[model samples]
Structures are given as structure tokens and as C-alpha cells.
Target: MLSALQLHSRGWRVSVFDSGSAGRESSWAGGGILSPILPWNYPEAVWQLSRRSLPLYDALAPELAEATGVDPELTASGAMLLDPDQIQAGAAWCAAAGLAAPEIDAILQTRGPSLPGLLLPWIGQIRNPRLGQALRLRLRQLGIALHENTPVTGWLRDGGRVAGVDTAAGEHRGDCVVLAAGAWSGALGALPVAPVRGQMLLLRAAPGRLKRIVLDGGRYLIPRRDGRILVGSTVESAGFDKRVTGAAREELLAFAVGLLGTEAAGQVETQWSGLRPGSADGIPYIGEHPALPGLWVNTGHYRNGLVMAPASAELLADLMEGKPTQLDAAAYRLGAGRL
Candidate 1:
């Protein structure tokens, strides 16, 4: 939808086709951390797209709320890293990236392990489901065709060049086609993408219980505006199975309770899972296909799709329009050693 929105704004007729209900998959299930959870751990390619995309939400969130009447609550709640070991590297990365150095011991209230933490006060998050809702509404208001539950089975070809998609309804001929199918992109061929299941739990806590996002031991706690704290997630190589497991639930509950104390034990509202488009490395493919002309791709985003959406859309749009891209486009091309 972000890609469609970008293209439509550039005077192009755009249509979005989804195999299932739009935005109900990974986009809806993701904890909307606007920045990479552990920024220093990721590659330069991920940061290139993320740093550019993060700031775009400041203008986008309000635009969507004003236009669609749904506030995709973009909050600058900041992020705290409880792992004391990574503090030095994190601080170094921040300095190199021209960001403010993380303030040590920024979080005052803690009931769990007494570990030192570094806080990046500029970190922001969005209510991803609300963002998805706003994007869908905004797309429809702009007259972009949204074919929800319409699966594109194959490509509509014209001689050697790809033309459009083959849907169950019929062939929807177009000038070009973009495979932005997320984790399912590998099924369409030409991308080394697979489904990696991640399960998350939501807990309804008091509004001021947790002040900001907290990361520890590969898991995170994201506090929402309406007193609902999101506890996530378990990274498992469980293929396409999105069924929430009892073990995952118990594990997440334990983690939440450990951090927020025993009071959080009964705050469990619901548990859900999402299939991220796991690439070999975390960098996503965001350019035209070398084999199929006029067939572009914007998939393989893996865990960072929500964070990288805007800049990924912008990069894809710039490439499609033959404009000079903001970042080095060569790094994200189809045959850029992603496999």
C-alpha cells in the first residue's frame, strides 16, 4: 500500500492486489518500532533505508489522520537497551550516524534485574494496525484500486517483457508489476525469501506502568497510548505456521512478568503471530528484476519492513520513474548477493 501510495502521488494509476485481506498479515502483526530495535547490529543497507524512512512518519502520520480520520499513533516513546554489553558499540554507532549519544541509566522505574541501560530518546513507534487502517482508507480516497482477497496466481506476459498479473478474477493488464507480497514472495519465484514466524502477546496495563519501549534478551515491550502494552516476540524458524503456541505464550508471559513485576501476570489480553519475509541477510530487495523486464520487486524486507516501508517505497518509485534515488540503488538491486 505504501508503494501504491507513492506511485499514485507521482501521477501513476496504481492498483494493489493482496492474496488475503490487505494489511492483515505482517503489517498488522508487527510492533511498529520506527527504528531498528538494535541499530548497531544491522548492516549499513538496513540503516540506509531505515534512517530515511523513520523521519517520513512525522509528516505522514498527521496527513493520514487528517485525511482518513484514523490516527496512526506515531509516538516518540524512545527506546531503552538493557544489555549493558552493547552500550559501547551502540554509542559508537550513534556518534558515527550523527545521532545523539544514548543517556545511561535513563529509566528510573524497574522491578526486574538491576541492569544498566542506555536510552535513545529519539526512537519512535507507531500503532501498526492503525497505520495499516489509515493507509487502506487513504488509498481508497485517492481512487487507487484495492483488490483485497484477490490472489495473483501468475504474470500476464507480453512477448518477453512482463505486463501485468494473472488473478483468479482475470488478467489485470498493467504497464508493470511489483511483487510486494512479503513472506510469500518466494512462491512467485526469483527471491530468496521465506516465512519466519514471530509470536507476540498483548497485555493491558495501566497507562504509566511502562514509560517507553524496552529491549532485553532479543525480546521487547512496546507500551501503547491506550494502556495496552505489547510484549513480543519469539523468532522461530517455524515456516508458515502462524498458530500461536502455548510454549510461546508461557515464555512471553514470563518475560513480561519478569520485567513489569507480578502485577503484569494477569494483564494478558491476546496472543498472535506474524510471518516475516526472512531473507538470508536482513536487507530487502528494492529494485527491478534482471530476468523479467518491467517486473519490479520490493519484498524480502524480513523484520524491518514496517520500519523501512516509506524509504523502500521511495527508492522503488525513484527507480521506476528513472529519477536519481536518495540512496545508492545498486546495493538493493535484484542480483546484489542477497541469497
Candidate 2:
């Protein structure tokens, strides 16, 4: 959808094909944290894409709301790193990225003395479901054809270059075809993309009970404006099985209450799972296919699909249009060797 929007904005007659409802995958099930969980841990390339995409989301949400009349609820509610040991590394990463350093959360430390945290005031979030709705609406307004439940079975090959895509409905030919099919990208061919399942639970808490997104250990809790707090997630190599296991639910519920205290324990509203598009080397394939002409991929984002989608789409569109990209595109190519 991000790539479609970007291409459409650039005057491309765009058509989006999805096997299921838009955003029902990781995009819908994600906690919607804009920044990476830990910025210092990823490759420099990942950080570069994230740094570029993070700020774009701040404006993109409102712009969509104005254009599509669906408020995505993009919130600069900030985030907290609930571990003192990570402060130095997080600060260093922020400094290297030219972002303001995270501050010591003295108040959280005062309350939870065992786990001191750092405050990153610039981190933001979006309500994923609402964002998905807004994107669909915006695409409709732009006259872009969205073939929901229309699975692209394969590619429409021409003599030398290429034609477009083949779907269950029929051939939806275009100037270019982008395979942003998320975890399902592998179904078309051996694209080195697989599904990594993540389980999450939601807690119904009082509004304003939790102000900022909180991360501790490997778990996170995202507070919504409507008093729904999302606690997640377990990264498992569970293929495409999006089943919410009981063990995961129990563990996440305990983790949430452990951080927010037992008063918010029994308010567990819902639990679900999503399959992230895991790549071979943990980086997305975002360039033109080496073997197939007029074909491109923008998947393998894993957990950072929401974090990296904006800039990924921008970069993919730039490559498609033969425009100079904002960042080097060499690192995200599809095939092994280069030209």
C-alpha cells in the first residue's frame, strides 16, 4: 500500500493485489511502533532506512487523514527503553543518527527502581488498523485499482523485458509489478522470504493510564488512545501458522502485569498472532529482480515493515522511475551478484 500510494502520487496508474484483506497480516497485528525496538542493534543500512522513514510517518498520517477522512491516530507519544544497561548504546546510536539523545527516565526509575529506563521523546506510533483503512480509502480516492482477495499466482512474461502480473481474476498488466506480498512472497517463487510468527495480547486499561510506549527485555507494551494496551510479542519460526498459543498468551499477560503491576492483570481483552516477512539475511529485498525485468520486490521487512515501509516505498518508486534515490540502493538488491 505504501508503494502503491507513492507510485500513485507520482502519477503511475497503480493497482494493488492482495491475497487477503489489506493490512491483515503483520501490518494489522503489529504494535505500530514507528522506530525500531533497539536502534543500536541493527545494521547501519537498516537504521538509515528507518531514520528516513520514521519522520515521514509523522506527516504521512495527518496527510492521509486530511485526504481520506480517516484519522490514523499517529501519535508522537514517545517511547521508553526500560533497561539502564541499554542507555549508553542507545545514546550512541542516536548521536550517530543525529537524533537527540535519550534522557534518563528519573520518574520511572523512582517508581520501578529495579528497572531504570531511558526516554526517547521523538519515537512515534500509529494505529495500524486505522492506518490500513486510511490507505485503502486514499487509494480508492486516487482511482487506483485494489483487487482484494485477488492472489497474483505468477508473473506475465514478455519476450525480453517483461509485461505484468497473473492473478486469479486475470492478467492485470502494468508498466511495472511490485511484489510487496509480505510473507506470501514465497508462494510465487523461491524469493528467500518466510513467515515468522509473533504473538501479542491486548489489555483493556483506563485511558491515560500509560502514556508512552514501553520496552523491557524483549517485550513491549503499546498504549492506545482508547485505553487499549497492546503487549507483545514472541518471535518464533512458526512458518505461516498464526495461531495464538496459550503459553504465549500466559507469558505476555504475565509480562504486561509485571511491568504495569497486577491491577491491570485481568483486563486481558484479546490475543492474536501475525506472520512477519523474514528474509534470508534480515534485510529486505527492495530492488529490481536480477532475472526478471520490470519486476521488483519490497518485502522481507520482518518486524520493521511498519517502521521501514515509507522509505522503502520511496526508494522502490525512485528505482522504478529511474530517479536518483535518497539512499544507495546497492545494499538491497535482489540477486547475489551485481551488474
lDDT of each: 0.89, 0.85
* Clash pairs detected, candidate 1: none
Model 1 segments more than 4 A misplaced: 105-114
Question: 171 in model 1: Cα distance from truth in Å?
Answer: 0.4
lDDT of 2 by residue, 1-339 (tens): 999999888988888899888778889999888887887887767777888997788779889999988898999888888766787788777787677744554545624566667788878889998999999999888899889998888888888655788889999777788989889887765588889999999999889999999888889999999988999999999877888899999899898878788987789888999999988666788988777777888889988888888999999999998899999898888876422
Per-residue lDDT, model 2, residue 250, is 86
Q: How accurate is candidate 2 locally (lDDT)?
A: 0.85
- Residue-level lDDT of model 1, residues 224-253, one tens digit each, is 998899999988898888999999999999
- Displacement of residue 334 (Cα, Å) in model 1 is 0.8
Q: Pick the TM-score winner.
A: 1
Best by lDDT: 1
Task: Indicate the TM-score of model 2.
Answer: 0.95
Model 2, position 277: C-alpha lDDT score? 90
